[model samples]
Target: MPGSLHNWYSLSWLDMLAERQSVLSGRIELKRLARLRDMLHAHDGSVTVNLRFGKRDGAWVIVNLECEATLALLCQRCLEPMLHTVAARVELGLVESASMASRLPEDYEPVVLEGDRLMPARLIEDELIVSLPLMPKHAHTSECGSLVRRRDESTGEAWTLDCAPPTSH
Candidate 1:
């Protein structure tokens, strides 16, 4: 229901090409994709999608999708919040039937549509999550350099250096 566009394929052959080939762009609220929070940490901002769909190989469908989304992640060193952008480009095939899965090329990942409809939102979300960095670091590492305090092994007390003095004048 949330990620559905059932009527997109109902247009006449010529009209469908005219409308679907041009970029179909829209913003999907992040709240809708919150279900994947466990996989997509600190997610925020609207998920932007640009897509173009067309027929391929007579019956199969091809969808070229581009997506962008922002995520707030904790910096690994300082534990401060940092904004990270996720972008992904994917070309997917919608096979006519499940039986075609075996015949698909090694590089292609076929997505079977339930009922002649395609939901770009869900696909975009999946790609966004996959494209996210395994470890997000601060863009400005110098700002957080001072915050990297380490504890003395003996005393178990956190310590930070004020500054390293210049050796030569």
Candidate 2:
């Protein structure tokens, strides 16, 4: 059987909160996620998101986004493929424009409504990208292979730098 409209991928943020609508949950293919393109090792997994709409502080329309996924990234320390799990929950006060987003309450981040509606997939992808580490690395440097030694001219001795190569996945 076909899934109901409840499975629809996008909707009007304002309308959803006003009516206290059902949560929107879906998968976004990794290949289709643009912002995270450079970080992914193989573009092989999908991000799953569940968007729940409601009123925050009983006054403002807020969208609670829950996103989860495992992204393949090249470890900065090891320069090898590594798996990183991204799980994030964010609450945003939906607004009409960029300026309005800046004026939202301290507790609520602002997400400007681009048109009348919002694309859950796009939002999910953006949030996941934000959650990734700036420079992804293994938990321990020991996991990194041999450290290259460079000869210091002043001392005429070889020195090993602590950091490894920064690799894209």
All models: lDDT? Answer: 0.63, 0.70
Worst 10 residues of 1 by lDDT: 5-14
**Candidate whose lDDT is highest:** 2
Extract clashing residue pairs from model 1. none
lDDT of 2 by residue, 18-134 (tens): 467557677777887777877688898787777787876566677788988999888887676677898888887777778777778878888776664566666777788888888
Estimated TM-score for each candidate: 0.62, 0.71
Which residue pairs in candidate 2 collide? 41-169
Q: Which stretches of candidate 1 lie over 4 Å from their true place?
A: 1-23, 38-43, 96-99, 105-107, 114-117, 139-169
Task: Give the best candidate by TM-score.
Answer: 2
Error of 2 at 137 (Å): 0.8
What local lDDT score does residue 152 receive in model 2, on the 0 to 100 scale?
49
